[model samples]
Target: MDIKAVQSSYARWAPVYDKTFGAITNVGRRCAVEYINSRGGSVLEVGVGTGLSLEQYKPDMHVTGIDFSAEMLQKARDKVQALELSQVEELRKMDARTLDFPDNHFDTIAAMHVLSVVPEPEKVMAEIARVCKPGGKVVITNHFERKQGVIASLERLFAPFANTIGWHSDFEIETVLQEDALTLEEQRALPPLGMMTFLVLGKSGG
Candidate 1:
């Protein structure tokens, strides 16, 4: 995938991103935040689009987010500033494939719906793993292209185009995490979007 093109496209769509995909279950957002909050320490959020997950995070928790698009970060900045969380939250424009943080620096790391858009999803996830503490968690969710069938066939046909516009690959959740040695702790499947799956994974430091 073209990173610049993806960034530009998201720059244009950042304004309406939340309202559109936001139509999906707020449950996922809430669950992600609560899970991170429960850890009670510094958090790193990759691809923090429009701050939809902010509503669920506690203001006391230290949170830092990074994204590839300054335009998207702009929308998120307003909310962080509005909530007086500027002290606790630092938003930076960055590429997920190469994170700037040191090893084992975060208590929790999240990449909600982020794996799909990057050119190298596995590399990004590995980077997420590298920054996370030995036992830290990585929360991820994406609408997958269902298993071999008519729907899957159709998705495969249009995948190249869909991918260009920031849609997900047909990757199975398990496959992505396997290379990083992360253990899945929970899973949630979105209704109607059978391909959509949410997972909470723990780094084994193995």
Candidate 2:
């Protein structure tokens, strides 16, 4: 998807996101956050739309979130204020392709159910690798296209509507795995018929 498509699609979905796509992706979010909480430290949460996972982060873990949508970020900000979540250090509007943070900044980075929605995911992944501290982990949860199955057929059917739907149904896992500095450490399928996947990639040094 292009930036305009992403922006417009999310602007439309932002109002009902928590009950719609957000609910469908809840398991992935929970699994990712639980794992991050276990490895508590400085975290950079990419695509932290509406801050749905913000409250679940352990209080001891320092968290910073970034998103491209102002509408979504506002909701996230409101949630942070209402809940008084002290762990959240900041939430900024940013493009994942060009993250504003310095190199080796965060201990962990989370990209939950968002790679397919953003433009230039490879560039985003490169930026993710660049900023993550060596030995830190990049956690991801996303729906990847199946090779052959009823799901694969369904994915093809919806592939054309990615811009309108706000996420690519045929998104490939390889798009996020090409960064040399990050090595795949774990991979697993998530619930709801294993449509979604959980991945952990460790940065190459400490």
Candidate 3:
């Protein structure tokens, strides 16, 4: 996926994002946050669109969120300020592929519903692995393209519309696994006919 394409698509979607895309992604976000809350540490949330999941985090946990879309980030910022969400350490307007944070910064990093929308997803994964503390966990929630069946065919057909849709319908699981620093710890399927996947990856060392 291209960065500009992602940006433009999000810009258009930003107005109705909460009622639309945000609702659809709620299940994965909830599951990811519940798991993170149990771990309870410094967290970095990549692609924190509209801050829909911000209020659900534990009040004591420090959460830093980053998103590539300025418009989307603005909505997130508004939510934080309006709700006085002190748990949100920051809501940054930044790119995922080249995170500005120092290496090994966050104790737990999350990439919920974001991997498929980013350009050079491998680079984004590398950044996630880099800023994550060794032995830390990275939680990911996204729709991975299926291998067969009618859904797979539809995904392939919609592959060309990624630029317009803002995410890859045919995104593969392997794209985000290229970062060698992380090892898959667990995997599971989420709601709505199990279209979305939840993956728990651990940074290789302590």
Residue ranges of candidate 3 with Cα displaced over 4 Å:
none
Model 1: per-residue Cα lDDT over 1-206, one tens digit each: 67877887787778888878765746566667777888788899898878778657786788889989888889888887787664346889899999999999998888777777776877888898889898888887676667788878877777768535676556556556675457788887855555567788898863
- Cα deviation of 64 in candidate 3 (Å)? 0.5
Taking all chains together, the TM-score of candidate 1 against the true structure is 0.89
Clashes of each: 1, 0, 0
Q: What is the TM-score of each predicted model, taking all chains together? A: 0.89, 0.99, 0.98
- Please give, for residues 1-206, the per-residue lDDT of candidate 2 as tens digits: 98999999999999999999999999999999999999989999999999999999999989999999999999999999999999999999999999999999999999999999999999999999999998899999999999998999999999999889889999999999889999999999999999999999999877
- Candidate 3 residues 1-206, lDDT tens each? 88899999999999999999889889999999999999998999999989999999999999999999999999999999999999999988898999999999998999999999999998999999999999899999999999999999999999999999999999999988768899998899999999999999999788
Off by over 4 Å in 2: none
Question: Ranking under TM-score, best-scoring first?
Answer: 2, 3, 1
- By TM-score, the best candidate is 2
Cα error, residue 95 of model 3, in Å, equals 1.1
Task: Give the local distance difference test score of model 1.
Answer: 0.77
lDDT-best of 2 and 3: 2
